[model samples]
Target: MPTPLYQRLAAHYRDAVAAGSLTPGARFPSVRSLMAQHEVSLTTALQVCRVLEQEGLLEARPRSGYFVCHPAGRPALRLNEPEARPLDPAAYVGMHARVSEFIARGRQQPVKVNFSGARGAPELYPAEALRQAAGRALREDPELFVRAGPVAGEPVFREVLAKRALASGMVIAPEEIVVTQGCIEALNLALRAVTQPGDIVAVESPTFYGLMQVLESLSLRVLEIPTSPQTGISLEALELAVHHGSKIAALVVVPYLQNPLGSVMPAVNQARLVNFCAEQGIALIEDDTYSALLDEDVPQRALKALDRTGGVIHCASLHKVLAPGLRLGWMTAGRWQARVEMLKYAQSRHNDGLPQYAAAAVMGSSQYDRHLRRLRATLNLQRRQVSDALLRAFPVGTRFNTPPGGLSLWVELPDRRDARALFAAALAEGILIAPGVMFSNVERYATCLRLNCGNPFTPEVAAAVQRLGELCLTRCRPGAVGSGAAGSAA
Candidate 1:
């Protein structure tokens, strides 16, 4: 499922184009120059240029060389972030219904173009390489097929994971890491280890639906804290919530490229969060699912990396950046490592050993780094393309987040138009979209929607976006009150 090397080399120019460093009509580097600069072979150089041309980023003239060709004249969008809400503790309810209905509708009807979930294309995953790795492992240890693995994951896989965790700014012992089915299971184990059934768990307003689902499944009440569309959850609001006596047991947060909003918490905020959680005796369950998708300059700033008190339960998955089919995610439970491992054992024993072997082989080898690089590159291009499409299709005042990483766009419709209405209309037209209200347990952000940019921005998708805009213009106009969607969603 992984992309070719030419795609990796093409990602360099793709980054430049995404950053606007290489504007429309800007000439591309010559093939010979690219070969010399990247230290690639002539064939790779040609393939890179070929991909660029095929993707419409470049056009070749009769005598002249390749030059940039992309969407032009799209106006720069201003940030119209959601209003901040004070600490309001509420229980999770019917969230799965909303999300399930959206999913079920897509399945029942034929979805022509999907913008619902933030999932990557198969080309972004390293499947063939993983197959080869699995083959090598099988040949090396044919008995592994019959042998049962450790209850806390194979030591070799844990060692590889611990070393890779260093890149996220945390030095971990392999013993502290328990490989789970995926990040979801890791999150489940963390929550189960920390709190009882009725205990309250704090989360950001308009948080990831999956997290809400987890809280619901565990019978945990939710205390909603106001979060910024730019920086992430506000520490001041959370402190006031806790100090005001919410009796919050744990805080489950995504600090990097958070889903729906696509916000990356700043380093200072990360430090403050860790310190606050530790001082407050609150278990900090940090989801590093999107940590690998953070911007290059801010890559090392994970909440766990700032944890000096070992209070942060760091959870991460290789499912997104590595082989997508291989369900491998690990978590270091810090002080609760024993409890987490016990919960994991009681729940599902351990992940399959064949996958562990394959994952370890891939992680230890050089292909892991290559997969991450090309994955980021491909995601960057997809984001840019989708952003351009949105700008061209949606009306003025339709605000969206342009994160340096991740495959999400939290779009606020013009004049507070109804996002659910748009969702229904888009579904009728065979296009799927995630309504913003689904992110919140209560009715909020009805004017907002999340668009996944993982797929290629095809002409058909561009047309679907245009149609969706037309629906937003006509179906959900701005003029109502009491319904949080029309009034202040603060």
Candidate 2:
């Protein structure tokens, strides 16, 4: 049942009082003002004031109406520790090992169906194109095999990437491009270039956990704002935080096909956000990692394209759609092009030329468009099939957002059931999934889970989904499924 109107209204006033917006001895607004502000009935407004008065946030005064009571409770504010401290060189060395461990864990475990990642089918990679490109490079330029490539990246790949950036609405020159191992390195370099140890950064709640690790490594404090799984960040809340001098060095966002939750910000909101960031002097790092996988006939203009003030930093990778092992990624930093490039030079100098050439060959081919079309068709069909399967397999009350395009699904199970528990059970059944707790800041998304629909529709996947469904029923009910199913899960 929906909450009572007066109870909701009373709690709002109580929160305001506790937050110190309505201080002690401050005059309360009249019943008419409350009526106008809340658009509630007179009785409801009176009830709200009565509840507040009883709770000691207000007091009755003769002829003057109610006055705010003294000694309101305010949340305890403490010194926020910087995410990192002055770490010696040893710390950086240890940090690398820690990150390596994270990546290794992601790959070493074999799941029943491997719905843990949004990786595409390896069969779709253009093997023949890569072979031909490597052969041509070796034959046409034998000297290229012995020498080190340019620190910036391969020239042909840079030109292609620049042209594609312009097509996506970014006004960029070839000189502004910097290629790295992949999007991970691209983001890492961007952060190293812009942020310092002990700096504060604002990230969307339930962001990519990989980004969280980056923040941790840098010792950067994270101020999380509630982000809508559909529309990106809450702009008004961001403006408020920035106004309070949050010392936010950058705002990293995935405006196109955001991870875990496939949300695309509308063009109008994108423009508003771009302007807001510019006016507030906050740098916007736009991560378009999944943009290429969009199934839309007309893709939305990227945030970098709408940057009139040179505040948007654009990063993307070919690993998602084309070649993961290629590890080729590029970025266009508007004003900090030099800083970004220097960091890239310091990191790995440049990615291997063979892979870049191979990716470039495939990207530069006629089959590129055909391959994307086929991929989209397959993805769209699979999306429907997976959604239907989930609906049919799981019982009622299982909720998830319906993304227009992308590979993953964000599902919210019944509150009584924990996704971590489901994860343990599924792992035993050889099914692995990304529990939603990993995506959130407060780790409150215990009942949420993300599913991958891009992999092959194997019999293992079918059995895993069926097992997951049965587990859901058992958890949501006291004794819905028999103990035999639970024993099998164990």
Using lDDT, give the best candidate's number: 1
Model 1 poorest ten-residue lDDT run: 481-490
lDDT tens digits, residue span 1-490, model 1:
8988789879988899889998654468888899889888999999998898887787774455776764544443434444654444657555888887877888999888989978787877888888998898899999987888898999999999988888777888998899998899999999999999889899887888888888888898998777676688878889888888888899988888887778878888988888899999999999888877754733466788888887899999887777668878999998898888888888999788889988898889887777777878778877877777776777776777767688788887767678888888889889999988788886667777899888877888789888887888777766422354433332
Summed over model 2, clashes come to 2
TM-score of each: 0.84, 0.75
Residue 375 alpha-carbon offset, candidate 2, angstroms:
1.3
lDDT of each: 0.80, 0.71
Model 2 C-alpha lDDT versus the unseen true structure: 0.71
lDDT, residue 312, model 1:
91
On TM-score, the candidate that comes out on top is 1
Q: Measured by TM-score, how close is model 1 to the native structure?
A: 0.84
Model 1 alpha-carbon miss at residue 126, Å: 1.4
Q: Which stretches of candidate 1 lie over 4 Å from their true place?
A: 1-74, 82-85, 480-483, 486-490
